[model samples]
Target: MAHQVSASTLRRVLNIWPPFLFAGIRVRALSADYHHARVELRQHWYNRNFVGTHFGGSLFAMTDPFWMIMTMQALGSGYIVWDKAADIEFVKPGRGAVAAEFQLDDDVLALIRDATADGGKYLHWFATDVIDGEGDVVARIRKQVYVRRKPPRDGNG
Candidate 1:
């Protein structure tokens, strides 16, 4: 069973999360509702590409788990969520810091809930744009998440 945690606690934990910390990605903001979040990746010597641009892998990693994590939290313990697939398009070379904002609207959440209400599985696609300091899109990330409602457990009574 997934343990419930406060957003603040999650934020703190994610800050120290190895994948993020090693990549120089920081979780800048996460809304209490889990509906909105922002992550930024700084361009350092270690994380930059040969051309001195933000590494493509780092750009993708910055936004990787947000959608699935948010969906699982919003749907509660009854549902299972996992990242099924993802694709990234490098639009432009990232010269400086790049950030991605994740937003999950109530309507989308409602749709997912209804779609998976009958122990059914649903595949949903979400997108995030990695933007540079100049506000231009550096890359676009597309993710496919799989969600399913678990079967009811039998009581020991």
Candidate 2:
């Protein structure tokens, strides 16, 4: 069985993680079940671009890892989850704090379970929009994750 990791622990760890800390990204909220998460990035001189707007890289950084994290936690030890690929589009210049929300629904979870039951890997795509303080979308990001069931272990023990 896999060890359970709490939402608060992960939030705290990620908050201080170098990439996020340096980019001014903060994990504001994570649901106890790991089905929902909210991340925010505050614009600062260090994270601003030549035009004084939120850097595109920082905007992408704020959204990275969320989809894979959610899927891994939900699927537990029986599966292997990895971030396969990603793409981000800047919809508008982010002037201030920008945030993104991630949600894993039951239907999706069930779909994942069904897709990977054959022990073959499955690639699933998830999308999220980074919105400004006024709720206007600042960027759109799509993440593709790979998941597969673990092969049966030997009974040597």
Candidate 3:
């Protein structure tokens, strides 16, 4: 994990990574604040299923880690963040390119900060929709993120 990348850097690097490059998944945009991001997955032969639609795994993969990453960046270095659970529902068959947008609002950030202020663990759920080129919903994704502020190390414990 020597590669310490910022949001903008990761946005560019992920676009050329093998899994994304091969599957036609692109990181369209990543805000400098790390509060927002956009990702898309094109329907290429390799990423298509036997029925000529998007593969379920690829759809899930495109969304995986985004919420966790965004939350981690928003929470900063003093907190530990991890993905607790996830669920995906395929609303419709993805026939073409699909995209998802991720966002972290200030209120939500405040909520997390307040809940974890006492070094307590909090499980927060975030949801995103995968939409097609025409803005039709293709899938819905929900991810639970676990966060806890690290304990002070003043030899008090």
- Number of backbone collisions per candidate: 0, 0, 0
* Residue-pair clash count for candidate 3: 0
* C-alpha lDDT score of every prediction, in listed order: 0.90, 0.92, 0.89
Instruction: Write the number of the candidate with greater TM-score, choosing between 2 and 3.
Output: 2
Off by over 4 Å in 2: 1-3
lDDT of 3: 0.89
Ten residues in sequence with the least summed lDDT for candidate 1:
1-10
Instruction: Compose the digit string of candidate 2's lDDT tens values, residues 1-157.
Output: 4456988999999999999999999999999888999999988899999999999999999999889988899888889899999999888899988999999998998999999999998999999999999999999999999999999898886
Model 3: worst 10 consecutive residues (lDDT sum):
1-10
Query: How much is the lDDT of residue 125 in candidate 2?
Result: 95
* Candidate 1 residue lDDT tens string, 3-87: 6677678888999999999999999998888898999988889998888888888999998999998888877888889999999
lDDT value for model 2: 0.92
- Relative to the unseen true structure, what is the C-alpha lDDT of residue 141 in candidate 2, on a scale of 0 to 100? 99
Model 3 Cα lDDT, one tens digit per residue, 1-157? 1223598888988889888888899999998777999999989889999899999989988999888888888777888889999999999999888999998999999999999999899999999999999999999999999999977789876
**TM-score per model over all chains:** 0.96, 0.96, 0.93
Model 1 off-target regions past 4 Å? none
